[model samples]
Target: MIPEFWGNGIAANPDNYLDEDEFDSSYEGLLRLSERIGDAKPKGVPEHVIHTLPTKPYLMSKARSPDERCTICLSEYEHNDWLRDLPCAHDFHKECIDSWFKNSDKCPICRRSILENKEL
Candidate 1:
């Protein structure tokens, strides 16, 4: 057989289509089931870990540039805005990032695990 597809071995298998028919039910149902079963996704970090994230008032003088904005809120940070600094060194508004931690344990920009130094 001649090599037709170029990457990732997906082309090697002739039946490459997703079995969507088997998954036709709404995603919300699956999400709810997963939430109840507690296995569809990896668990997020503990609340204490989130609460311990370092935060400081935004100081324009400390920023590398004035154009820095929180990727979560997509707004240029204003002076004195409370911001949380992730271990990856990325910062976001306190409210913005705190809300984010409720759902994920990784940095939004770099995807670094926020569980780095925490126990449990």
Candidate 2:
């Protein structure tokens, strides 16, 4: 009787690689790997993409108080005023943020880069 390993062909040709069917299955396994690699590639931000980023750190007093002033322009924030917050936790008035983003992709106060220069 043939040994179990020989019957499976593993012992018969130990040095041989996987057959086409097995190779195909393994190749399909790389779909997610390719997707992850693609996702990791850096993407370009559109020139027209506008971000309402804050110009200063959002202090608890500024967030809670209606009379708090924006340090950028030294103007008082009024009730119901529209503001935008950045990932760095800074806050700014909407209009100020809009104008700032249009000119550059850096945080108005800290100058942190919002978008990076892509190598062509």
Of the candidates shown, which would achieve the greatest lDDT relative to the real structure? 1
- Cα shift from native, residue 5, model 2 (Å): 69
Off by over 4 Å in 1: 1-32, 62-66
**In lDDT terms, how accurate is model 1?**
0.83
Q: Residues 62-104, candidate 1: write the lDDT tens digits.
A: 5367458899989988889999999899999999988888888
For each candidate, give its TM-score against the true structure: 0.66, 0.42
For 1-120, candidate 2 gives per-residue lDDT tens digits of 678766766777756767767554366677765765675544433445443333443335534665466656768776567777766566777677666666566676787766644322
lDDT of every predicted structure (CA atoms): 0.83, 0.61
> How well does candidate 1 score on lDDT at residue 94?
93
Clashing residue pairs for model 1:
none
